[model samples]
Target: MKLFADYHTHTIYSHGTGTIMDNVNAAKKKGLKEIAITDHGLRHFTYGVKREKLKRMREEIDEINENNKDFKVLLGLECNIISSDGQIDLDDEAMKYMDIVLLGYHMMVRLKGVPSYVHIYGRHYLSKISKSMAEETRQSNTDIMINAIKKYKVNIITHPGARISMDTGRLAEAAAKTGTALEINSKSNIMTVDYLKVAAGHGAKFVINSDAHKPEDVGNFRNAIKLAEMAGLTSHQIINAVKS
Candidate 1:
């Protein structure tokens, strides 16, 4: 299997070390056909892209697309799941500027309300300490993620089992139904081989991404590719890959 695109990449708009152009250049250098400039959403406390800058980022990407006929750059946001009810940090206004949407569970997001805080964050941490809460939290997390997939036009779920614990089979079932690909992130080891196998068994599609924070790291899918291979995933099951 060979990947043709790197859908989950970061830029200076968020916590990344490179500009959008820098990442684009890096992807090109790595011989990738396409890349997405997926910065953090507006709610990430430390690294979220400023809402006002969305327009500017859109313009930048447009110009790049105009100049390069052989390559594609998609403007997307690595949006946060802000509430237990599956409300993400993205809105219709933000959606206008996006070519794709990538949602994931991340810590330190400005959530919907206190209720969301208690349900999404409080319980998550509490589960770490209490064995009884672990199963409940895992179920709740899976339910919340499935809700989000049903609620939004999410193209991908970045690193499903990364920041929190979730039932991979359950989440994958919902993702397959909704046509949302689960990410195999190269930057983190959260998506284990076991998780990949479980998710794939539910007929869910996948994407291998660098999750690159630096320009030079763009299109670096080695780790993710190895894990996917270990899980016996073929190109047909991966959105960005092709049979070689």
Candidate 2:
């Protein structure tokens, strides 16, 4: 299989080291047909994209698209799930500027309120220490993710099993219903072949991404490709892959 587009990439707009143009140039060099500028959402405590700069980013992307007819760049946000009730960090006004949406569970986000904090962060950490809490937390995490999938038009769920435990089988069922693809993130090692198999069994589509934080890594998919192969994934099951 071969990937034609990378839908999860970062730039100076978030915590990435390169500028948007730099990443675009790198993707072009790597022979990618398209790439998305999916910076972290505004709720990320340390690296979220600035709300005031959304218009500027849109203008820059428009200019690039006008000048480069052979390649495409999508403007998107890797939004955070800020609440257990499926609330994300994106509003309708902000959604207007996005071409795609990628949601994920991340630590250090400004959550909705105290209840969200206790359910999302507090219980997550507690599960690591208590075996009993682990199963319950895993169920809660999966349910919350399912709620998000049902509530939004999420194109992809980035690194589903990374940084937190989730019931891959259950989450995949929900994702399949909403046509949301699961990301195989090359930069993170949390997703395993077993998890992929379970998700695939539920008919969940997938996407392999470098989760590139630098321009040079824009289209790197070696690790993700290996995992997908091990899981017996075909191009037809991957949103960005094609027969090679």
Candidate 3:
């Protein structure tokens, strides 16, 4: 299956190895029509892009895309799903610069309030905890993402069931209901056959992305395609693969 766009790549802004222009150039070389530089949110402790940095990032994107009409380089964020209430760091001001918003659970986000504390820190020993507690935490995380989709115009949910505990089936259904696409990421291990099977059964549309941190890795969707094939996913089911 061929990909038309990759809207979930990273650059030096968020611990990535390449620059914004480097990612765009790589996408051009690979014949992709579009790409987005989705840095981590400001709440991420170690590698998050600061709030002020987003304006400069948008400037760079505008400059690059102005001269390079053949490829579109979008400005976006891989926003952290911070609270069980589905409160992320994305705000109205930030949305002005974003063409796509990718949501995922990350361990390094600054946790505040009881909901964030429980899901971000409390989910570590899910297996060791009581069965009821584990189930509660899982449902909470799942609802967080579900509510995130409803609360925000999220384009994709990256790497579902990767590092956090969640009920993937329910998450998939919520995403589908909200017109959000579930991602088949190149780097995350959660895009397994069974995960795709469950998601697809819920009628979730999918987007395949490299999740590339380096320029060279930019349009590489080998792993994503393999998983899709394993789950018997048609190219039509993949949003990014569709001809516009």
Candidate 4:
């Protein structure tokens, strides 16, 4: 069997309704080579990973790593894009301990209302559509995301098209330039086929993620694979965390 891995997941520290041990146990049962615990960054209005929780999560991951030598566990953050200007919620100090930092825009955090671009295109459109000011946010996100990769050398960016939007072409361009991978998140609404095709067309690398909140959800990569094949992604184009 191909080595399976899921790089976007949450634990109880995230208020994710599951324990860290539950996630690890799930990974073991699913036969995954690795699972990344990427709980929401500190900006989540109601439930976010605070410094203390992150420390504890790391300690837990360390213990899991020692015990479960058969599997690799990654510590990560699904940092919220706090504003349209694209600034991530975590400060420099908070990001130091993380293995990966994935950025996303949340409705509760990023937008006050549907931006004009989304409104004009229809609210359901998954591609990034933002006002000029929102571009600052998008650009800020782009810059911040790119800079995080440069600064911390984080491996991947989480779902690019959640509540926030960006120009896929530009994002692909950035991903290519930065050597970072963009995610096809299965747990969120599937990445639009058009966006996937456009991204692959640009030679951007990709990551398939479940964004799993529960242990049972860990290795569910079905929708992600469908989008990948639809986009004509080959194994070489995917950046699986467990693989080289």
Candidate 5:
């Protein structure tokens, strides 16, 4: 398979095992034209990259670009979605330094104090919450997703699955209107065939990502390709950063 770009990647700067050079080398080995360093944004309690760390990573990328002419590294941030209440941890100034901004729904940090449990299993597996709380969480996630697209003009929404709650169809419409690609992450098996069918029906463009937290995972686009095939995606329906 021809791998053009792997935009969702993590480095040691984001509390991962991979380094900036490790990722770039892996991508070159995989014959990719470009790759992005999209580590978790600041405010993630467990493993997020701070602004200073991001700057350092950017410098490393610049150095690599100056020395190597084979691949391009785009600096990016996987900004965590704070809540369905329209809260985000990253600001515009922070966004200005990034080439791409990706929004993901994870429970590492919840501003509403709804407990970190909401993130581990997402709204789908919560058996202990009251109906009201569940509904609130769901609404909050939907609102956050919509607002993230409107607020940042984000390049893509990363992995809106696994532990997140939102109407896929509605979110797809918002993505289409905002020009934000909805990512099909290979890290988790959350973007089910049915979900892809729904999103594709709404004319949402899909971007494939490795979501590689380690060097070994970089450029492994197998699962994403299978899911896209299951979704009946045509070549024109998928977005390739190099081709774009």
Candidate 6:
């Protein structure tokens, strides 16, 4: 299977090694139909895009599109789920400039304060997570995912349960209900076969995204395709894989 469009990727604006044009160039070389430049949102302490950089980013995307009409470069952000209250870091005003919107859970996000951020990192990043704590975190994470889908016209949920555990069945239900695609993320393999099975049973549609940090990895959908196979998913269930 192959990706028709990769909707989640990062660049030098975040933790990625490549520049925006570099990713676009790689996608063009691969003959992709579209690619989205979804840098980490402002809540990510280390890798998030600076507020001042938006103008440059917009100009770059426009310039790339103006020069090349064969491929489309979408301006987007990997928005952080900042609060337990389902608050996301990207606001409507900031999102107006976006062609695609993606939401993901990250351990390093600034959730209202330093201590809260530290607490989040400390809890999820620890070597061992207790079953009860993991279960609680799962429910909370699922709620946040459902809320984000309900509140925004999110195109994709980057990697649910990739860091924090989540109830995949409910998440799949929400994704199906909202017409939002559940992502089979290439970067993180936390979404298990069991999780995919539950999700598939709920009639959830999936999108396989490279989640590529480097330019050359733009169309690498190997891991996602392998995972989907384990879940007994068919090409009809994966949006991008249909063309492949």
Cα lDDT of all candidates, in order?
A: 0.93, 0.94, 0.86, 0.71, 0.78, 0.83
Q: Identify the candidate with maximal lDDT.
A: 2
Overall local distance difference test of candidate 4: 0.71
Candidate 6 per-residue lDDT over residues 1-244, each given as its tens digit? 5557788888999989999989988887876788899999988889989977987899999999999877889999998888665778888678767888888888777797565454455555542456556666667668877987898888888888777767888999999999888999987888889988888888899988999999989878888889998888888888776453
Report the Cα lDDT for candidate 6.
0.83
Which lDDT tens digits does candidate 1 get at residues 1-117?
688899999988999999999999999999999999999989999999999999999999999999999999999999999888999999999999999999998998999989999
Mark the regions of model 2 whose C-alpha exceeds 4 Å error after superposition. none
TM-score of each: 0.98, 0.98, 0.94, 0.80, 0.87, 0.90
Clashing pairs in 5: 84-140, 84-141
Return the lDDT, model 1, position 137. 93
**By lDDT, highest first, what's the ranking?**
2, 1, 3, 6, 5, 4
Model 4 regions more than 4 Å off: 1-3, 83-85, 110-154, 241-244
Worst 10 residues of 1 by lDDT: 159-168
Poorly placed runs, candidate 3 (over 4 Å): 126-132
Better of 2 and 3 by lDDT: 2
Alpha-carbon shift of residue 108 in model 2 (angstroms)? 0.5
Put down candidate 3 lDDT per residue, 1-244, tens digits, no spaces. 7888998998999989999988988998998999989999878999899889889999999999889767788898999977767888898998899988998888878866876686557765664467767777778778878888899899888888888878999998998899899989988777679989988999999999999999999999998888898899998789989643
lDDT score for candidate 1 against the true structure: 0.93
lDDT of 2 by residue, 1-244 (tens): 7899999999999999999899999999999999999999999999999999899999999999999999999999999999989889999999999999999989989999999999989999999899999999999999999998899899999999788788888999999999999999999998999999999999999999999999999999999999999999999999999765
Which residue pairs in candidate 1 have backbone atoms (N, alpha carbon, C) closer than 3 angstroms, thus clashing? none
